[model samples]
Target: MKAVRLEEIEQLFLREVERPVPGPDDLLVRVEASGICGTDRHLLHGEFPSTPPVTLGHEFSGIVEAVGSAVLGFRPGMRVTGDPNIVCGHCVHCHAGRINLCQNLRAIGIHRDGALADYVIVPQKQAHELPLSLKPDYGAFCEPLACCLHGIDVAGIKAGSSVVVLGGGVIGLLTVQLARLAGATRVVLVTRQASKRRLAEEIGATASFDPTAGDAAAGIAGPDGLLPGGADVVIECAGVAETMEEMPRLARPGGTLVVLGVMAKGEKIQIEPFDILFRELRILGSFINPFVHRRAADLIISGAIKVEPLITRRVSLEEVPEVIRNPARPGEVKVLFMPSA
Candidate 1:
């Protein structure tokens, strides 16, 4: 089997490795499609904490090539999306139903061999069934959509609400659609990329903004700006220092700010605590998909969330290392690796 392995920090290569055999409670999925995430780049550059000498693809879905004896309700030939995050059920957070906060968290691609290969093992608990009829490339989006779903869940978007999405990447674009589905009447996407800005509006954003053109905070929240008095909810999905620093200012007094972006570890950004205190704003840090993977799968399967537009390109596993080594191409949203290609 060929697997894209991160031998160590700043080292990544597609190496031939022995195929993995599934454990009693696991499923051996033949990798079909896996999305290259920003976290993959983070892992490569040692910006994020990840156990090296492991395969590096977390957002993936594939066909079940084989199943463990203990696996139930699933069989060979089933199409499924894997929830890469594994939690210890006995952890305090897990007991409290906060599994994403589990103290002993081990994630596929980050800590274990993942779907960036010919085969990857998925615990039965982490596999979600997808219709065989679903597009193979679309299945790869389930993981990212799941993470976005968690962000939407915590944002508390309501009917007639207004939302400002910072960044026009896949996460931000997905968040825009979810916000609209959650009943936000007005959704504004903030990004400098003209192409992504155009795509955002076409998808669901009521409007879009170019931060490089003028003052983003004032342009979105100024008395004469789009939202006028700021948005009901502001989500920072750019995962950049500039967006992180400007996130709070885009929200109205007493509104919410959800940090759904994955910034590198040890990254710092200046923020004003006084504004949050004075406005009594609600600020939340949404981690990985906790209990929303199923909903994300359903949304994707049902075509409730449009993912086809978010896919920028599809590459082979051989091209993955180079793709991850460089920055995402201009206006690129999501790139998937077709293992069988």
Candidate 2:
């Protein structure tokens, strides 16, 4: 089996490795499609915590090549997506139903061998079924969509509510669609990329904004601006310092601000605490998919959320290392690795 291994920080390579076998409650998944995420880059640079000498693909889906004896509902031929994050059930957070915040958390790609190879082992509890009839590439999106769904759950979007998504990447685009589905009538997408802005509007954004053109704050919340008095909810998905600073300003007084972006560890950004205090704003941070993976799978299987447009291109497993080594290409939403390509 060929796997892309993060040997250590700043050291990544594609090498041949022995195939893995499933344990009593695990499934051996033959890698089909895996999405390259920004976190992969962060992990390569040691910006995010991860166990090195491991495969680094968390967003993936594949056909079950084999199943453990203890596995119940799944068979060898089933198509499934893995919830990479594994939690210790006895942890305080997990016992309280907050698995995402588990004190002893181990993620599939980050902590162990993942789906970036010919075979990866998934605990039966982490496997979510996907329809065989669905597009193979789309299944990989279930992981990201699950995380976005968690953000939507945190934002508490309502009918006729206004939302501002502060990035045009896959997460932002997915968040835009979910906001609309959550009944937000005025969904605004802000990004510097012209193409992503257009795509956001096509998908669900009622309008789009170019933050580089002019004062983004004034243009979006000015008296004659799109939202006029700011939006009911502002979700920061860019994960950049600039966008993080602009998030609170984009939300109306007494409105909500949800941070779904993953900023680099030890990074610093300037924000005004007085504004949040004066406006009585509600701010929250949304982590990974807690209990939303099943719903994400359902949405993808039912075609409720459009993912075909978010896929930029596909590459072979041989190309995975270089793709992770370099920065993402301009306007590239999602670049997937087809293991069998």
Candidate 3:
């Protein structure tokens, strides 16, 4: 089997490896589609914690080629999406139903061999069934969409609420759609990319802003701006220093600010604590998908959250190492690797 291995920090390659076998409660999925994520780049640079000498794809879906003897309610022909984050059920957080914050956490792609190869093993608990009639590429989006759903849950969006999404990447775009579905009437997407801004508007954003054109704060929240008094909720999805610094300023007094982005470890950003104190703002940091994988799968399967537009490119596994070695291409939203291609 061919897998994209992160041999070590700053060392990645497409290597031939032995195929994996399923455990008693695991499913051996033949990799169909896997999406390249920003975290993959972060892992490559050692900016994010990951176990090296492992396959590097977490957002993926595939056909079940084989199933363990202990598995039930699933067969070898089922199409499924794998939840990469596996938690220790005995952890304090898990006992409290906060599995994402499990004290002992091991994630596929990050901590174990993942779906970047010809075959990857998924425990029965983490695999969600998808209709065989669904598009293979779309299934790859379930993991990321699940994470975005968690962010939306944390943001607590309501009917007629206003939202400002900072970033036009896949996460940001997905957030925009979820905000609208949550009944937010005013959704503004802020990004420097003109193409992404246009796409955001077309998808669900009531309006879009380019930070490079003028003062983003004033343009979005200033007098006569889109949201004259700031948005009811501001979600930072860029995972960059500039957006992280500007997140609080985009929220109205007493409104909420949710950080859905993943900044590199040890990175520093300047934020005003006094401003948060004065506004009495609600701030939150949303981690990976905790309990929202099923909902994300349902949304995608129902065609409610449009993902076809978010897919920018589809490449073979051979092209994945280079894609992760560098930054995303201009205006690229989501790129998937077709393992069988």
lDDT of 3: 0.94
Model 3 C-alpha lDDT per residue in residues 1-341, reported as the tens digit of each score: 89999999999999999999899999999989999999999999999998888899999999999999999988989999999999999988999999999999999999999887888999999999999999999999999999999999998999999999999999999999999999999999999999999999999999999999988889999998999989999999999999999988888999999999999999999988999999999989999999999999999999999999999989898999999998999999999999655
lDDT of each: 0.94, 0.93, 0.94
Assess candidate 1 and give its TM-score to the true structure: 0.99
TM-score of 3: 0.99
Candidate 1 per-residue lDDT over residues 1-341, each given as its tens digit: 99999999999999999999998999999988999999999999999989999999999999998998898999999999999999999989999999999999999999999888888999999999999899998999999999999999999999999999998999999999999999999999999999999999989999999999999889989999999989999999999999998988888999999999989999899988899999999999999999999999999999999999998989998999999999999999999999655
The residue-by-residue lDDT of candidate 2 on 1-341, one tens digit each, is 89999999999999899899899999999988999999999999999999888998999899999988899999998999999999999989999999999999999889998877778899999999998999889999999999999999999999999999999999999999999999999999999999999999989999999998898889999898999999999999989999999988888999999999999999999988899999999999999999999999999999999999999999998999999999988999999999656
TM-score each candidate.
Answer: 0.99, 0.99, 0.99
Pairs in steric clash, model 2 = none
- Candidate 2: segments with Cα more than 4 A from true spot: none
